[model samples]
Target: MDLQISVFLLFILFTAGHSFRCYDCLGLTGSCANQTVQTCPSGFSQCQSLTVVIQVGSITYKTKAKDCAPFCQSGSINFGFMKVSYSCCNTDQCNAQDAPDPSNVPNGKTCYSCDDWSCSNTVSCSGTEDRCIKATWIAGGKSVKGCASKSICDVTAFSNFKGISCCEGNLCNCEGNLCNGAQSITQSFLFLCCSLLSYFLLH
Candidate 1:
């Protein structure tokens, strides 16, 4: 009877210590085609796939990432020239599928962007971007004006770029010569965190 009880307790402990497995990978554009399995850390509740696309003029940049995430809700954020989309699933290895491509259809909103010394250059807004943003950094003597989605515009921490302002309506970004300095730390942190997570999971 003691041996039987010991065996049952061992089984319980083994099940309790089990961790979820997820696919993990990271790459720029097409590099994520190959992925590896990873054991999720304790308390991580979901597997996630994230895709980011940035379009400037005729050039496009893309990134793909997958890892064990802490219960992230799936959604998309569009900032006129940039877009980020993410999907999460609770099942093991459910993040194997790729994220869908971002929509290219113009959303009918327009804003001003700076190129070289020109702040009057027009930028066509797409997706959920509905605000014109102007950010400037006094120390760096840099400024930028562009269209942003509600999510990106809502980020309050600009770090070195103290001059940050946003407005709704077409061509609102061209009203001022002083431009917004830097992108929000939140977006940078998001990308950095995902990169680190993928690195740790792979190594």
Candidate 2:
């Protein structure tokens, strides 16, 4: 563990020198803004500044994170500290109706969880998540008909945050950790084209 900490600190020093490369390899840290993050093994443990700004009609909402992941790497790998920002914008015929009322969203109506996806504990308000969450718009009306048949969702849908599920039947759930089966594919039409290109050039 001490060795890991030392390695992390050393990376911190290197971060000062290889600033641009550090930006690209940004890891499991919550999507924060203008902060330095450090994690080990996979190697991203902290997100220094998480600046989130949301513009909603007449009101603009902004917040920042001043802490690293909730727990240290040695003892905990699931707990993460991240800044979350959500804004309600105005549509063509609608103005921003809500501004993420704290009473509503430290655990919001939209926040959800899903364990079947075998997702990593990336820090969420409501434990687990929903597969599909949709909201319908409220058109200009007093009663506005049936809430079920309303048609459009008022809020953005939070569905399938993580991708497909993968596992070894009963042994391991390494699919999510490594590259997903879909994107990690090697056999493809493009591969065939590249192979043909090399052969054609040699000929």
Candidate 3:
């Protein structure tokens, strides 16, 4: 009887310690107004909030998402085309607030960037974009190059881009100026938050 009682107490303690909850919602604008509380899965111990802003020519788009996450790191990333910011917390409903926008001020870093199918254009990096990124299609050989925030250079983040690679140093996307042509020896990760922006914009 004592063993049975101990087992019951242990289960109650474990269950109480593992439980977590967060707000879950996604919106096209800077914030989500209609969020619902959701119990997180066993391994999900953090509440996450993400904000993405993208610019194309004269227009700009913003997206926000909040949910329970297994793990999260608060940070921001800036690519020439888009900027993303994320915040995480361990308490219930802690992600109710929106993540802040990434800084727009130029950071004085530069890299080769693609413009209208041309990879020779120079682009000034801004905010947290301290690394250079190069992504090439395996079959087509077509490539895109630009500056990226270090947080977005995670391997798991660039998995969708396949041949995507990142490197450090100014104008280091390739060995020569305007030569975003060959793959460099160093490679790193990419954040898929950019893809999230694309998905939200498309659907």
Tens digits of per-residue lDDT, candidate 3, 1-203, equal 99999999999999778668898888876668888998888788888887778777678888888888776667655545666677879997898887777777888988876543345667787777788888753323445577766665765334224466788888788646447434332221122334446543332
TM-score of each: 0.53, 0.19, 0.66
Better of 2 and 3 by lDDT: 3
Better of 2 and 3 by TM-score: 3
lDDT of each: 0.64, 0.24, 0.68
Best-fitting candidate, scored by lDDT: 3
Query: Model 1: residues >4 Å from true position, as ranges?
Result: 1-11, 106-203
* Best prediction by TM-score: 3
lDDT of 1 by residue, 5-83 (tens): 9999999999888789888987775457889999998788798887777665688777787888765546444444555
Ranking by lDDT: 3, 1, 2
Which residue ranges in model 2 land beyond 4 Å of their true spot?
1-80, 83-90, 101-122, 127-203
Steric clash pairs (candidate 1): 134-180, 135-179, 135-180, 135-181, 136-179, 136-180, 136-181
